[model samples]
Target: MTNGARDENVTLEALCRGDVRTCARLLTRIERGEEAVIPLLQALYRAGGNGRVIGVTGPPGAGKSSLISCLIGAWRRRGLRVAVLAIDPSSPFTGGAVLGDRLRMVEHGCDDGVFIRSMASRGQLGGLARAAGDALTVLEAMPWDVILVETVGVGQNETDIMRHAAVVVLLQTPLGGDEVQAVKAGIIEIGDVYVVNKSDHPAADRTCRQLREMIARGSRLRPDRDWQPPVIKTQAHLGVGVAELVDAIDGCFAHQNADPEAARRYMSDRARHRIGEILRDRLDRRLRSGDEGWLEGSIEPVVSREKDPYTVVAEMLSRL
Candidate 1:
């Protein structure tokens, strides 16, 4: 039905008004890689900007899903409309997610004010799938008060989530001194708020102490900003500390709002990163499906070193 008729049934008005069925169908088209929705996406971009995008990221087994479930209940209690975009592991053949819609059922399944959807990571090394930005774009167009993005468990290599989230919450399982020392680099620096989940564990206090020391010692990704990432403890399954986490998230937003220059600085950086992400994705598709089979045809020359990778990149850039 979405072959060429971008406006066949779905309308921006419906999306902006938070029409569930219409937006779900539009999201389906986006996941299927339908180009017909491009025009609508462009239009949506101009009209959209109402939602607050918060990103939650952590390593596997950190209880990210459980924490998020608790978070949904908290937000709903405040009478806020919330949406979740959970990134799940993909089936190699079908690119279907292993987890997503099922995660939110117990707490928020029947709530009309809550909307949850999942996308497959499609073998991305990062937590997010390739279509994540587009999917997020769709959600931001809606009347959601808060949009939560939960990506697959990630590590040092996963920086994609930081680009999309206005505020980032990094979750940790209780770790020992060495374990905490090990995470002081890439992934840890991007956190706006740090959380030690499974706080009931014996090591939780130690973990929190280690994280605070690290945060105090480390230089942040946004060093010029005054917001110091707080390390809090939580047992998410028991609904412990979730409210504090929410408060921490709110504080981060307030921090941004109070400083227009800082907000603009971070947003400018995010915009640059967003542009690069889209450009890279488009160039990847071009190299994969563009005229006369580019990647396949050039493999032998590049592999044999008759042409170095730099030369090959130069040639490709010229074509682009």
Candidate 2:
């Protein structure tokens, strides 16, 4: 093998052995879309399939970061190593992350068992970075027992990103008008556990009631329900009711593990999503690297109304 290949193998081995620096380097490479990332991710994939991937998603201002902080503590108390991938919204001008979720997780910075990484969504609309699945693969190679993925706080659109997770925790608060309606419409179904965070609010109980009703209605519509997510109230800042939330999360994980078919289905879905993403990225790269002059020529004719866009695109594809 080449020296570089050997060095990469050594790095991967160190990552699997719980080397945090190596893991961070791999994640950075993945985020930067380096060519080496593909092979590195493949190796990590082979070393993965161990960590429980939990997705935490909700609307903005739902205290997701605070809730995650509590969760990290809870998992640490159980002697389980935890890793967090917090997806932050990107600045439109600079394409850098605007809100650094890691800042909220300062307490765990010194904890050797806790690893936190903030990823920029880079304007991807689904509340996740395009490379989130690959990042998860990298984390899987590490010795973390639990991996928490926090989304970009996009309400309904957030559900799409949770498909990679084994357990989906949907956080909501008492600020409940359109937000609750959005959850009722679609997001509720994706959650394995629902948390009403900031439950110290006066409207907390009412919001919980609304969520229970929505879940009940959903359960009725799908008679073959295998798992019913429980709604737990939590004042995350105060760490109130967080233990119960952790219990619910653990129960969800246990339920998925107890059912082989369910676990297999989740894995299969994740694989399908990853494959689709990779194919899209590859096609995009190929298109961008194609004859730029030809592409501009094709677009000019269409823009000037000399040709229809559909015909131009068809002709371009035929040439390809």
Name the regions of candidate 1 deviating beyond 4 angstroms: 1-10, 91-97, 176-183, 219-223, 290-294
lDDT of 1 by residue, 1-320 (tens): 66445464348878988999988898888877777788888888777777889999988778888898888899999999999998888887786656743464477889999998877788887789888888888888899999999978886668789889999999988863465564557787778999999999998988888888777776554568788899989998899999899999999999999999988987898889878977887787676564556656777888888877887778877886
* Best model per TM-score: 2
Pairs that collide, model 2:
none
Q: Where's the lowest-lDDT run of ten residues in candidate 1? A: 1-10
Off by over 4 Å in 2: 178-184, 221-224, 315-320
lDDT (tens digit, per residue) of candidate 2 on 1-51: 998789879988898898988878777887787876677677778878778
Backbone clashes for every candidate come to: 0, 0
In candidate 1, which residue pairs get closer than 3 Å at backbone N, Cα or C atoms, i.e. clash? Answer: none
| lDDT over C-alpha atoms for residue 94 of model 2 | 86
Error of 1 at 155 (Å): 1.9
